[model samples]
Target: MNIATRTLLVATAALTGLAGTALPAASSTTGAPTTASNSCPVKAWGYRGHYMCGTKLKAGYIDWNRDGRTDEVFVIAPNRHIWHTWKNAGGWKEMPGRGRADDMVGDNGTGSRSRCIIVYVIKKGYRYYQNCHYNGRWHNWTTSG
Candidate 1:
């Protein structure tokens, strides 16, 4: 067969193989367990160690402790509040202030992946806020434009 035909067949076969798969539903907005468990089944890399199963937005990961390793994750929950957890930790915890976010960004600042900084836009007011971990502690969250 021609290259185009062969590619089509391969794609079809791959899709067929995935037909029986079903992605887990997003976690409920209320009464959802805060700890990770087998029922918290998000098949994504960010879900590797935490309890955030049905996050509403893409997950963000950072070193968070300046240890040159990415171990923290931030995700927007189904209720719009931002929640986070660490690798091999206890469970997911809501961010301070319980602010809702429309989008989030995380980076290591000017240093390596060790330095963690996160900025998120509020879902209601569209204002920006940020927090960072430095000097052996996490700075308070502050608002900005």
Candidate 2:
């Protein structure tokens, strides 16, 4: 084949390969693949450090790693289950307990450089459960019942 024809064929093949590339799918709170037809009740939300696309009822962020940057993202997925992911991993994982909660709140720990995360889960009408990530570990769900 002539030089011009050969060069044109090579360029066409490269363009075709580029056009066929697939993108990674966004994940739901359960780590399941999410598309446009999922049954998530609420719309996706943008957390401070990361974006969560699922049936996210509520979401909050904290510096769970104590790295001075807000990197941890927590969300209330379907069935009132709490799921969390960080900026580094970008994958959602269920919280330690299997308990379902109605609402969730997060806050940073006290003191300079404390870098701890305190999460509160509200259930029932007047009951609240607490959990925390401190000193590089997560504490299980706790309630004063």
lDDT of 1 at 37: 39
Question: For residues 8-81, what per-residue lDDT tens digits would candidate 1 score against the true structure?
Answer: 75455333321222223434432223343323433233343233344333437655455777666676543344
Query: Per-prediction TM-score, please?
Result: 0.48, 0.49
RMSD to native for every prediction? 13.1, 18.7
| TM-score of structure candidate 1 | 0.48
Model number with the top lDDT: 1
Give, for candidate 1, the lowest lDDT window spanning 10 residues.
Answer: 15-24
Give the Å shift of residue 39 in candidate 1: 15
Candidate 2 Cα lDDT to native? 0.46
After superposing candidate 1 on the true structure, give the runs of residues whose Cα lies further than 4 Å from its correct spot.
Answer: 1-59, 64-69, 108-116, 122-126, 135-137
| lDDT minimum window of 10 residues, candidate 2 | 43-52
Which lDDT tens digits does candidate 2 get at residues 1-145? 7899957754553333212222135454436224433234322233221222332334365654566765666664433445666655545665664534444545545344444333333323334555666666666666533
- Distance from true position, residue 32, model 1, in Å? 6.0
